[model samples]
Target: MKKIVILFILFYSAVFAQSKFPVDSSYTVKSVYDKVKKAHPYISYVPARNYKTVKEEKEIVYKKIKDRELHLDAYFNQTKKRNPAIVIVHGGGWRSGNKSQMETFAIEMASKEYSCFNIEFRLSLEAPYPAGIFDVKNAIQYIKKNARKFNVDTTKIAVLGCSSGAQMASLIGTTNGKIAFEEPNSDKKFSSKVNAIVNIDGTLAFKHPESIEGTVAGLWLGGSYAEVPQIWEQAAPLNQTDKNTPPILFINSSVPRFHAGRDDMIAILNKYGIYNEVHTIENSPHSFWFLNPWFDETIVYTTQFLDKIFK
Candidate 1:
């Protein structure tokens, strides 16, 4: 009896620990800052400042799936006219990180007359691939359903993602109209399609010549390149690119590996005559969007691209 009880205890403990492989708190703006501060000492945390003209609302529940409740922060200017909306997705290798990292972008974009949402989704630590994808896509449906209240211009919706989030954003944006990626619970009246995408320092392909992805990425993606070649290709924006893909803005850092398959994706986009843009921040480190100078610089490019497409 004693031996059986001990075995059960061990099994329960192992299961509990496995369920939280990557603790969300383990990754934060401060943590990322600490890791890169030594290499780029000049970089500093981007302070959050409301435009004052824009209203900020946090923790708005967007979706409830089983035990998981997803939420987002909304920043919008009180206006009589409908405004463009941008759904912002944060990055932590898809394992850790939260919507709060995008608070600054939401606030600033709101001040610029854009209804911006900093959205949260289950990370790989909780629910692996496609689950997070569906969460974000469904959040878009929720945003569209409440478009009138938020003064959103449904025709002008966009998505902006950083690192792994960017990879997902590209996947979601390009896969628009594909029934294969649709979630049954998503709003039937509205689809999870966007007019534009902004990818920040994210890979276009996990299996490309310039890709450095290995164990760290493979963990979230289910397996290594060799173990799951088809899955890797399936997730790549390069593979999903079609003539229907929306206009994209690539705000890349100096790292080349992160830009893997980007040029190829661009080639396809150009073939279809779809609008696309790329701007690499010289000497900037990965995740530079969290730092000053670059943070503001990113907003500039973002708003500019948005205006070109939606304004």
Candidate 2:
């Protein structure tokens, strides 16, 4: 009888421990995270959306290029009713990476009562810079065109991205009202303006002609700094800063060389008294926050920021 009681107590303790996070485990992509399943519940919690319709579908929004597949995942819950929407962009230096990295994030947002779209754009090597940005613009128009089907509020659309994805997100968010990014063939005139933006370790200085040299900027932009200085200069988000720009949340590591111009972007944002927050991980490695303790921290801070802005 004593042995049975002892085993019961042990089982309960193990179950409780699993509910909490494992700070000791190193961060890994979602696929490898299954190994530490016993110690982490956050992993399972992210991809379970409460929406009525949750599925994957592919569409061809751009026609200039063939074989370009635009993959999207969506979630919506009727009980929750109409909610804000957020489009997510994953980072792989513009050359690689896919929409799956944000599957858990999309689910989490849906659980929070926001319809979410995890989208994929063209890669630099495949089509290049303006191409990806153009892809984003088309995706927004497509969403707004099908807003009724997705149950999105349309007016409360927001965007979030990390690393290279951050750069693309910033560009789309900042250039919302601009005419230069408009798709010539599409009749969908819904404003591209995003209500809020969350950029993690993204560059804001793509507009600087001199800075465009010798980086992925060249490949994505389809030319080196020398070849198309003007395109690089105007393509960056810093050039589009203004008072009406949406609220922004910036999260980054404390690395100096990589994040050199983020402070200036923050300063520009302050001029408008528009809400902005920067959370820097002291001495943390670049993209370090994407792992464990920091990963959870990112979600908490990001969700809090979203709550404040969206509410």
Candidate 3:
């Protein structure tokens, strides 16, 4: 009787653990940061390192229309054989940020044998609504067109973005081959489809009741949900899901505001039988990708997700 009771207890414990959320549910931004800092004092204080081993090619023009020149930075391990690739977009509330913001993460990914492209897209200051979307789509098309030059496996490409960039990455992943978002001058011959996506605490829906006026999404989208309902609906990634949507992995911060509408997006994904995962970093800020401890954790889940889909 004693042996049976112990066995049952152990079995129940294992099952409960397995069924729990994939992320650390207990950690919050402040607590996790404090804990990590206590152990590694320099974890959040260290400057971004430009991995010396990874070869980097900067400012390669990916799109040229009229006088406007959009460029992207590429990083990779020198090899003749084709390898999986990822295009990373930076986030700054849709109005700021550049390719440099993604340099550290891209370099680390390149060191891991993935061809990484840190891309530049038009910001709200330069263009609004679908302009950034078109720029990102063009970047993917450019990468696909130059796959041989970069030794990138055309079929095994993924996109990763943080903040507003995550919104863009999610959009690109969900609306692949959708004609409505395609740019006029983009090389449409090469499909802009990606195999997977990684969204780091980005907004997924602009029409969420929580999305108010003066917010990043509202401003970048050129109006509030009530003012331009059509545009809001059109810009939302959650509404764009279909059976063909690629697998997505969301690495989020502890802030509930950052994950608004994520549950609804996941529901749509499930309804379509699409693969998706959400892993939250407890007690971490929305910008956790730039800090340590959380940064390493981000890479682990990212690499795991990409590997699973690419395989």
Provide backbone clash counts, one per model: 0, 5, 5
Top candidate by lDDT: 1
Error of 1 at 168 (Å): 0.7
Q: Give a tens-digit lDDT track for model 1, residues 171-277.
A: 98999988878887677898788999999889999988899888767877788889888888888888999999999999999999888999999999999999999
Top-down lDDT ranking: 1, 3, 2
Off by over 4 Å in 1: 1-22
Report every candidate's CA lDDT: 0.88, 0.70, 0.82
lDDT of 1: 0.88
Q: For candidate 1, what is the TM-score?
A: 0.91
Please write out the lDDT profile of model 3 over residues 131-227, one tens digit for every residue.
8888888888898899988879999999999988898898898898888888877776899999998999988877566543256677778877778
User: Runs in model 2 with CA error above 4 Å?
Assistant: 1-67, 78-80, 207-213
Task: Report how far off residue 180 is in candidate 1 (Å).
Answer: 1.1
- TM-score for all predictions? 0.91, 0.77, 0.83
lDDT of 3 at 288: 83
Q: For model 1, name the residue pairs that clash.
A: none
CA RMSD for every model? 5.2, 12.4, 17.8
Evaluate residue 1 in candidate 1 and report its C-alpha lDDT on the 0 to 100 scale: 100
**What residue pairs clash in candidate 3, if any at all?**
27-282, 27-283, 28-283, 29-283, 29-284
